[model samples]
Target: MRLIIAEKHSVGQAIAQAVGGHMEKHDGYVQVGDDLVTWAQGHLVDLAAPDEYKDHDWDRWSLDTLPIDPTPDWQWKVSRDKGADRQYKVVAGLMRRGDVDMLVDACDPDREGEAIFRRIVKHAGVSKPMRRLWVASLEEDAIRDALASMKDETEYQGLADSAMIRAKADWLIGMNASRAYSLVYNARFTVGRVQTPTLAMIVDRDRQIAGHVARPYWKVVAPMGGWKLAGERLDKREDAETLLRIVNSDDFAFSIFKAERKQQHDAPPRLYDLTGLQKDMSRLHGLTAARTLSALQSLYEKKLATYPRTDSQYITHDDLDTLRGLTEGDRLAAGFIEPDAKPERPHLELTVNDAKVAGHTAILPTMQADKAALDELGDDERLVLTRVVRRMWEAVGDDYVHDVTNVVANIDPHWCEKHPDEGRLLPEGECRFTSRSDQPVSLGWHAIEHAAPQEDHGEEDEAAGNIIPANLAAGVSIAPVPHGGATLSEGKTKPPKPFTEATLLAAMEHASRWVEDKDLKAALDDDESHSGGIGTPATRADVIEKLIRTGYVERKGKQLRSTEQGRSLIDVVAPKLKDVAVF
Candidate 1:
């Protein structure tokens, strides 16, 4: 008999169905014809926690165990997740069967996936010849294809080694730092390769904001037609009042302002990776990053989208044909050519870069989706799938076209002088100018309607307002109309915003530059090094949520702020241990 072990029950069931395995209900196993199929609920076993050691008085948190290194003899235990013990018993029983010939690791094709299978098999003491079933999508056809092309487990030894190192490193840091800080600071403080730096980032931002001091500033305003033309004034309010008097005193002649048209192309947005999806969901629908991830996971399980926990926003050459076919008849597909459309010279430039992608391809629609099926999904799940489907169409769609225009006008002092109090303008000697742009054109992907803005907006909206219009040539003049007492604006130069889940994810993705050391960033970016700047996609969210739950980080509304307990922990931990580079 051949034994197949899957990372989770759903995947195992999918593979069993694809491989012509007849399902039968058994005590601890799913008897699939001659194959004994068993599943792990994520991880069936994990390294025992510090309190579980039960040996020394060190069960309580203390700084003495600064770095809890897991020795070769370190104990392991079954995970506390319900059904883990039963699943393990089933797997062990299947392994003990006399007719079993070999074992198949039909897990998700990633590092953590590799760790899940290895830990289970090692704990179960199974020594059978092992083959790996590495497939990206859970589609039945994909599973069958993977089973037909199974590779020897030895081929993934490096991946397994890397996964083991990551798990052990997390265990070392989380256990030691958590205990050390909890004891010293008298707070439940947890830290890890990913979480500590993220918390530190939030704390630093809060400090910068607290130290910021506001300064008063003045601006000139000219109302022309229905639009208001605004410009900044010097620091002195007296200077602005004098200018306002002069402009109001005269009626300025209007000249035709310069008008020039230029074509601009905005490439359609790249396909969604987990982080990108999370950011969009947060910005558009007020979905928390964790909530968005949950919806994406559901979509993946339903086969509506590709794997959702991936970091890559580009697909390989092999997936191009399927991608093209999936979007062929859709409304957005009218402008996009299929991959085979240009057969001899495929235009794969859209998502074909080999250097950028790893583990899995971008989030995309699987061939299994139908418009009617989407109606059955919950609101959040439907929203996530809609994003995936829209992104797929947009990725290959035409570039967004825009006609940008910059209009600048000189302020007339006489007009300002005529309505001194009404027109808040700079003095005649002070330089003044105003600029405006026509409404933006939405040519392609930008045409997709996003949800209307919520009543409560944030800094992101202010930043979006700062997009500059096209350049304006000098010497354009326009008529100035009386301004009705617009209040001058003032603000302090603000510090960076604290890391919301959205921003923290961005920081992790770009963690290479967190350290000023050039060599460290280079090493992290290099493909040869096992540790990328960010933690693995599968574990990054967990790391973040853990920090929040353990009081190392606190979420205030949408902002993530670090606690005093979190700061003290960082000060105590070895610098390298807190850095993501150590991973």
Candidate 2:
């Protein structure tokens, strides 16, 4: 007989179904034919509390008991949740059952999941032969495939160790620093391994915004047929007027000095990692990162999507067959995919590399989601699922091909009146102007609206010029028209917008700038860095939510702003704890 332990009851049920187990339900567990299947509500066991350490005053939150450390014999206990302890007893009882000979660690396939299973087995003191079931999707075929290919549990010791270190580090910092700072300041300063530093980033940005000063500027533009070209921005108002007057004169002449047209292929976006999905959800639906994660998690549990906690945005080369089927595999996705849409060799190669993948491939829709089922989901859930499905098709899409034309001109006020007969004109010095535009050779992925269009404001955006057709070539002289009407328009600089959860998460992810030291910044920015981005992908949502729960951050609409209380804590907190570099 075999014993199967899953991360949760729903997953346990899925595993049992895939294995063709007999139905026999019991308290905290169920029996399936020759196997005993059980589930844990996340982690049934965790590190013991400070009070659990004998002969220590760490239980009290006082200055004397600041740095709590239960070293050497670090204690472990069933978590405080009533269900956890009750379920732990149930699993422990089954672990000793004479009928069961082999143990299967069927938890979520990630570092945290490894930790969860190891802690349970260790606490129960089970010494049976153990195996692992690593599944990227909960779909029946995927589960059965995983069960058939289970590996020895010892293979995952490295992952389990990583989780252990992460958990212990979090406990040490959250326990010690929170107590030390709170006692020193005589206020409840809820410091976190990730939360405090994240809060510090927002506070720093606010200070920069508060001190920002806006300056004024001017520019001159000329219209030729449909195209509009802008002159350089002039610091003085008189300089802009001089250029405008020169262009306004009928005698003014200019020649297109450089006219170049180049075509390039634009590649499609990669598949959605958790962070990338959170960003798009925030951008498209105004959904917070936490809300998006919650929706995606629900989809995963329902077998409509793959695992949601992954960091990789690429799939392995081996998953190509399944990845191909996913394109038009289910009826719901068929409607969104182009009829001829299939990922080409080049496209597949771009998104498939075995080396970088960890835990799971990027989030994607499963074949189980049909039209009716997809429609039954909430609007946000449907939106997320549709995006994943579309991205699968898009990731393999043909490149977006287009041509960019850059036309440069040199204008001379006196040359037009004197050299009316001349077709080719002067050297590079006088008021230089340039016009640029892109022409599409093929719509490719853009035809399906695979991604939203983001506007680009180049240097010539000063006067909001139009994209001129690629008509005028080098040495071609054209008379200036007033259609783009010259103006010395003045505008003030603007402060950076406050953080929305989307931008805040991005800041955390790409936070190479949070610190000055190159090595330290590189470490923080690394996905596998000890304290990357203030928090890991699994915990960042909760970190943001915790800030709001504790009033360290407040929601002003979709934007996150540090509250006065939160700001005050940063103000009085010790320099090292709050320091961007040291922290």
Candidate 3:
């Protein structure tokens, strides 16, 4: 008998369906054709914690065990989670069967996915001819194709080795560092390879916000018809009033000394990767990053979407026809595409850089782009699916078009970078006052945004207030009404805004910015490096959620702030452990 073991139950079901086998449901598996198919709930086994080690010294919490490394004889056991033991027994039983000819690793196609399958097989102590079934998409055709081309598991040795090393390294850092800090502070401070650096970033930002003291400043605005032009800010009110008086004089005229008008275009947003989707979910629906991942996991399990853990925002050439058909068939999304929108050369060519794709393509809908499928989803799942569908349509759609204009008024070119008398003498001349305005030439891909069930960008555009009539030209003299909404205004300098979940996720993703050394920065910023960032996309949400769970961080509205305990941990923790650059 040929036995197939998938990473999850839903995947197992999909495989059975794709192969068209009669079903005989068994203990923790099902039978289709002559194949007995089973699933493991994520990982059935994990490396034993420090307490489970043989020596009592390890069990004791002290400074002597500052760094723990797993030896060659390190132990593994069934996870303590509820159903792990039961599922482990079932999978092991199936693998040990006399009739089973070979074992198939039908797990996820990434490093962590490789780790999940290998650990289970090793723990069960079942040796057989191992085959790999790697599928990027869960569509019936894709699954059948993957099965027909299954390769020996030996091909993934490098990926498995990398995954093992990462898991052990994280365990060593977390186990020793957490205990050392916890003992030193007399509190169970959870320290980790990624979580520490991520928490430090938030704490540093909070310090800046706390240290800030607001200062006052002044600005002058001139109202002309429907448009408003603001002069540069002045340190004092007298300086602002002096400029206001000059402009308020009877003979003074507003002339645009410089003007530029050009056509501008915006391509649709890149497709959803795990991090991008998490950021959008946090901002739009107030869902935590962990919650968003969980929702996406459900979608992936039901085969409604492609793999959710992929980092690549690009697809390969093989996915072109699948994506183009999806856009054409989706009724709600079809209108977003232009009548002339053909999946022709350049536009379809944009998403097909083979060098950028790895493991899996971008998150996309399977046959589930069908409008009828969305009816059974919950509200949060519904929102996520809607966005996924909308993004697909937008990716291949036309570029949005805009007409932009820049108007500069009351110019004196020599005033800037010109101090004629060696920083001392004569009268300083008036300076240029500039403003920008944009007119929408065409909606293009953005035409469907109004009809999609997506969130509005929470803030109005900063430059939206400056738009003017199309007929306004350079060198035209316009009368100024300085009294209405355009009078002199005074305000206080504000502190930097706190870090919200969406912004925090972005910071964590681009964690290379936290370090300054050129070589180290390169190491972190290289997206190709599997372990480049502080945490993997698969684990970043958990790292963030763990910080909150352990009292190292707290949520205020949408902002994530360091608590008193969290702040003190940073203050007292050893620099080598908490330092973002080194850690």
Candidate with maximal lDDT: 2
Q: How many residue pairs in model 2 have overlapping backbones?
A: 1
Error of 3 at 309 (Å): 0.4
Give candidate 1's error at residue 308 in angstroms. 1.8
lDDT of 3 by residue, 147-243 (tens): 9999999999998998898888788888987888788879878878878878888999999999999887777677766666767667777777766
Winner on lDDT (1 vs 3): 3
Error (Å) of candidate 1 at residue 247 is: 4.2
Model 3 ranges off by over 4 Å: 332-346, 411-430, 450-462, 469-486, 530-532
Error of 3 at 370 (Å): 1.7
Give a tens-digit lDDT track for model 2, residues 458-488: 4435333456665678887777775335555
TM-score of each: 0.84, 0.90, 0.91
Best TM-score among the predictions, by candidate number: 3
lDDT at 539 for candidate 3?
Answer: 86
TM-score-wise, the better of 1 and 2 is: 2
Colliding residue pairs in candidate 3: none
Greater TM-score among 2 and 3 belongs to 3
